[model samples]
Target: MNFRRLFAVMLKEMRQMRRDRITLAMIVGIPVMQLVLFGYAINLNLRGLSAGIADQAGTAGARALVMDMVATGVIAPTQTVNTPQELMASLRRGEISVGVVIPPDFERRRIDGREAVQVLVDGSDTVVQSAAVQLAQMPLDNSVALANATGAREVTARQIAVVSFYNPERRSAVNIVPGLIGVILTMTMVLFTGVSIVRERERGNMELLIATPVSRSELMIGKVLPYVGIGLVQTTLVLLLGLWLFKVPVRGSVLDVYVAALLLIVANLTLGLMISTKAQSQFQAMQMSFFVFLPSILLSGFMFPFAGMPRVIQWLAEVLPLTHFLRLIRGVMLRGAGLPELWPDVAALIAFTAVMMTLAISRFRKRLD
Candidate 1:
């Protein structure tokens, strides 16, 4: 209970903390990162969801209805299609979230109280689904009045028909299970590889490794190859559990899912190896992995709708491997999208793997110094 010794110990510990610059930076950086992501980036109240319009009516009424849907601030029309089939194709390719189909008989149908507009929604995302439902229920008296061919007519009936594609049942598992694969792989692969080199250095294995004939690039690849198999195993377990427990459907080819998972696993492993190359200790490696993990989870469209994020945030999110993987997995599992529909995301993952592997190899030195 000597205050003098206790204060001296506290001061010594403070000095030690100050010397660990990475830890010090993380202490300040992690909280600020969380604040910025949650406060500005993670928005649940979604708006400006990309939409496509297939206006077969080719009339003023159809155009007016499109404008009305845009004015709701729920959806923004980004593409014009000749048929609803094209709209669905765009949805499968992850190009748009909502689709507005105005039939050629729009004026006649509205007057006769028949369904005038078919609003097709990509229901794999619940936030977008909720917004589409709201748009369907909105009272568009002005648009309906202006759209009438003869004159302004008031129809006291619902005109928009909302059709939810993919997950018509609106099951959360349908959306979550696919995304869970990416999230789990990101966490495990990154963490496992993040500590590999650091652990070797700590356990006195670096000297033996350096004495071997293996080149730095060879060493890095060797370190990552085993983890790739481990990642694939983990992905299989998660998919099996999701199917058995949640009844999550895999609509696309199972091989496609594995292909996407493989790309993600390699990309994340390379990213972790790159982190390990820079980190001085396993503790620092873990901290850095968490740093990458938080953004991957929050900004990667796993927890929030990608369309809802601010434009700049969306751009930043595009750089994360998880963002693209989620799209690939969800597009495959939920939307039944094929490689033709998901080539862009596949390319992104490949590019990420290349960049990360280059960086990791470049950063690792053969010597312990």
Candidate 2:
């Protein structure tokens, strides 16, 4: 019931938290480090698939098919070889994702109405292969129809250019790395902040902190600052890994990611702080942290594509810090977006942080008695 005693306990808890270096590191350093690694390295869009062709027919008709495939933006034609052996070598060497082997009489058969040319599509990545196969087939079909409609007169093959927009290489790593950053930050900040506060209460040190002259605002800052620093350090380390290992480009301004992540970290920490305010024991806080984490990972578009989810689930995800962070990081990493594009996410986090901190502080009740 004594205000002075409660204040003293808060100060004591602050000192103890400062002394626990590992816990402090997890709170701040981990989130930032994770943001950098997971943000840029993960991508899913496929582009410019390499392909090799073996043109046995050596006729204008076979050449026309190759030309058509090249026109489709999906395949970058590497070499036109005389035999299957040469093209197989290209495929084995990983020079192409697809191999087009034209039989010697391919054009004659098509002209004779025997059968159509066969295309060998690598099925390793069904998504990428299907896209490339579909695009390449367009020229083959056109050539056949043009030849048939013209009635034995040699059809001049049409040269079509396929342009892969956005992510031309279709690498999934680009999407994954950016999204990972948001998830890691959410995990570390929420768990660390909530658990840290609840631990003080469990150890009976909260009473001692409440006894000191340290105000509630000061105590909150003292508890939060160390974790924030840890999150930042984590950000730096992950970014370095992403740059060196994944070869992911930082096309956007570094300050953009930094500002977005900072806001997200603050929101997550504040959410944790709010939960800590409500939890009576460390175990309860841990339970609440897990409760928040499950929904966060599921609803954050990390596992299921956000666009594919039901409208209600998507709406539920809208309020999560991780969801906003994902959009912010992806915009920066993929779109090379600046503050103008990311400001909405930043604003949402700021609003969430403000509300959560206010509620936690108001519920903090300066007097335990």
Candidate 3:
């Protein structure tokens, strides 16, 4: 047995690993990053969901009912509207998660043991819908006080009328399929383009590319353009399978979905190019892509409720391209939202593409370093 030789080889490998700082850092960084994200960022128990109040009753009792709901910690009333239509409009635009509509005949309905408040929920998100449903079943603590104020001895058992919009059936596929597009594109587009330049350098094509008249911008665009078509094809396949197997309906215009998908594809490709520029080898590029992929899947509302995350984590998630794309795809396919309702997300994707493309181009050099 060659114990001395084995020890010498082990020491040599350790020194080589030390020199490859990126690989060494990733070995430690990936696990720590996952632990922090799963512990602090991923939350299933949703709280403080944004809500709008349509207080047609406009009375002390109506206001008291709102306070009682707020005390449940299920929702935070962030906006007041004149009508249920306005409240629903806000929900359609993804501005609020829950809507409270106090009817004009609130006191009569309460005293007569009829339906009183209408709780409108955005049911596209299963977690938020489940919470809203629970809120509906809960008896408000202030109902007794309001009953006494109206000279009624007892309050009706059913005070809130809960209605779930945008997937009343609450199918998981409706939510998952749309977000799946983003996740798939992020994984493939980033990995494909991430290795492109590195593979060229490894295969000795860099000298040939440098000798050509191709500018850095031209090279970057050329690398990603083919992948854009590939991404759209993948998106189509996913959507078709979702519709055929799961019966997930595309309620909005298909063109809008494609537009969002295109922006996401380009953004991810540019991000990959940026990674390729920084990475010294194909292995390092793949590692970086995996790093980006983990956060995009976990923190981008693909697996968890976006509203459930803490405020700071939500703010950090806003920086990811998949976060905005998920909103756009889900809003279009599930909520029947269009350009008017989803312009903010579209703008965000465009801005992300611009920033990533600029960084990728600036960092990429025409010559081998």
lDDT of 2 at 231: 83
Q: Return the lDDT, model 1, position 265.
A: 97
By TM-score, rank the candidates, best first.
Answer: 3, 1, 2
Give the alpha carbon lDDT tens digit for every residue of 1-369 in model 1.
Answer: 999999999999999999998889899999999999999998888899999999999987777777778888999889999999999999998999999999998888877777788899999988889988888788785675674546635543377889999999999988998999999999999999999999999999999998999999999999999998999998999999999999999999999999999999999999999999999899999999998999999999998888889999999999999999999999998899997788999999999999999999998897788
Error of 1 at 310 (Å): 0.4
lDDT of each: 0.90, 0.68, 0.90
Residue-level lDDT tens digits of model 3 in 299-334: 999999988888898998999999999999988898
Error of 1 at 320 (Å): 0.7
Q: Candidate 2, residue 254: CA error in Å?
A: 0.7
Q: After superposition, how far is residue 247 of candidate 3 from its true place, in Å?
A: 0.3
lDDT of 2 by residue, 269-318 (tens): 98998888877677667767876786787667675445334456567778
> What TM-score fits each model?
0.97, 0.58, 0.97
- What is the Cα-based TM-score of model 1? 0.97
Q: Candidate 2, 84: how far from true, in Å? A: 41
